[model samples]
Target: MKAFLILEDGTVFTGTSIGSAREAVSEIVFNTSMTGYLEVLTDPSYAGQAVVMTYPLIGNYGICYDDMESARPWPDGFIVRELSRLPSNFRCEDTIQNFLEKNDIPGISGIDTRALTKILREKGTMNGMITTREYEDLEEPISRIKAYSVKGVVKATSCKEKYVLEPEDSKLQEPVRRVALLDLGAKKNIARSLVERGCEVTVYPCDTPAEEILASCPDGIMLSNGPGDPKENTEIIREIRKLYESDTPIFAICLGHQLMALATGADTFKLKYGHRGGNHPVKDLETGRVYISSQNHGYAVDPESLDPSVAVPAFVNVNDKTNEGLKYTGKNIFTVQYHPEACPGPLDSGYLFDRFMKMMGGNE
Candidate 1:
């Protein structure tokens, strides 16, 4: 069916509709990953956004159950230049079209994705709507989408209750390490990586209490990535502050990293365009090593607000020199503003997960 995407700027692109023929609106952003469309679609962090893939050709490998970051697709819509119908991977179970159709997510293809990505890079992320049936005048819908308030995006995408993703019995060599994973819009890959390392991960909602988290007797804590301003998430910051005195090693990523900074008396601010891609470069201060990272967040910890008594800057974004990682001076707390559990991105930073394992007293 004929479909089109309408940006808030009044720019429109026509393409072929592949997923459910329903109207959808979301903040429009682009990703530069060359693969992992399935994981991107299921990631909860993309909840209120329409993702545009810059790689052009997408869905060539089809979709598999193993790569899902959530139980269901969460992105409001998807856009690509081309989507392959035939997938050749041995693990392929369903085509991208089938998955999106089944999940009621709309997608449009055959558009100029390269041009769209360039525009996003130049003008920053914007609101957009994808429609199966076109209306003569798109001014109203575009305006509505542009002005739409998508507050509490973390709540909208977070897990309603606690759940576990366990590892196989044969994979366990010792008592299952317990981890309270605060799901401020967590991606499943993070939990999966922890499970693979023998940790029994219990995902909790964004507003889950510090008392409840302690009651779970977690050996470590994981704060996940999500959307929106970090200063607005004052409640979660309070909860994390309560956990700071404990010996539990706290590890955070992206938005979680920003919250960790706030919990420790640091501040956060918005980025002009923000980082959202697979190939961001970061420098590790201690090791003097660089790593390519996957990132998707619009807010960052203020470098000037670093608390010398509590923590110090650990890693920095090479592009904009933003605070990308933090290491507490005395506590067993550390965090990175980039994803180590790469989905469609590089794995150069994946070793950070092993570092987390080491902090938990697990031999890698």
Candidate 2:
């Protein structure tokens, strides 16, 4: 069936409908990754956004059950230049088309994705809709797009209740650290990553307070990534400030990183166009090393807004020279803006997770 994407600017790109017949409207963004479409779809971080894949060809490897970052797909809609109808990977058990249909998300293919990406780059990310409209006029869609806002996204995707998971049997030894993972729409891999390293992880919701979390007597705390503006999460930041005094060796990624900055008296601002891909390069200031990273964020910490006495730059993006990480002074706190648990990365960032373990005396 014929389908199209309508941007808030009244731009329309024609394409073919490939997923469910439902209509979707949300913030439109683009990703530059050439693979891992599965991971991108299942990542809770993409909630309330329609993703345009920059890579010309997608879904070539089909889908794997083990590759899901979350239990279900999160993107409101998907756009692609070409979707592989017959995936050839041996581990593949399902096709992207089927996955999209089952998850109630729409996918539109055969569009000029390169042109769309260019428009997003120039205008910054904006609202869009994927629909099989009855008419060609875009007035209604444009108006809806202009008024739409991605609010309450984290609450929608976060776990309703706390859950626990022991270390995986494949670990070298029994679990040592008990980690409190605050799931603000967190990806499953965040907990899996901790479990793999022999940490007993307890997942918590976004509304949970500092006193309640501290009662767990956790050896460490992980601020998991989520969707939306960091400054809007004022309460979480306030609780984080209280937790900071404990020097609990907190490790945060993506949204967590931003909240940590806000907790430490730093500020955050939205990017003109957010970074979303696997090939981004980052330089670690402390180690003086550069490594490829997997990233998905639209907000960043303002380097000038941070208090030098409270926190120091730990990592920075090589492309835009933006602050990518921070290390707190006189505290056991460190954070990164990229996903260290994302697979098919440089695999060098996982050491950050090890550093968290070491802080909790799990380095043995």
Residue 160 of model 2 has an lDDT of 90
Worst 10 residues of 1 by lDDT: 167-176
Please give, for residues 1-24, the per-residue lDDT of candidate 2 as tens digits: 999888888888889998988889
Question: For candidate 1, what is the TM-score?
Answer: 0.93
Best by TM-score: 2
Best by lDDT: 2
Q: What is the TM-score of each candidate against the true structure?
A: 0.93, 0.97
Which sections of candidate 1 miss by over 4 Å?
A: 165-169, 173-176
Inter-residue clash pairs, candidate 2: none
Clashes of each: 0, 0
The C-alpha stretches of model 2 lying farther than 4 A from their native spots are 169-175
lDDT of 1 by residue, 242-294 (tens): 98878898899988998888988889887766787889999999988989998
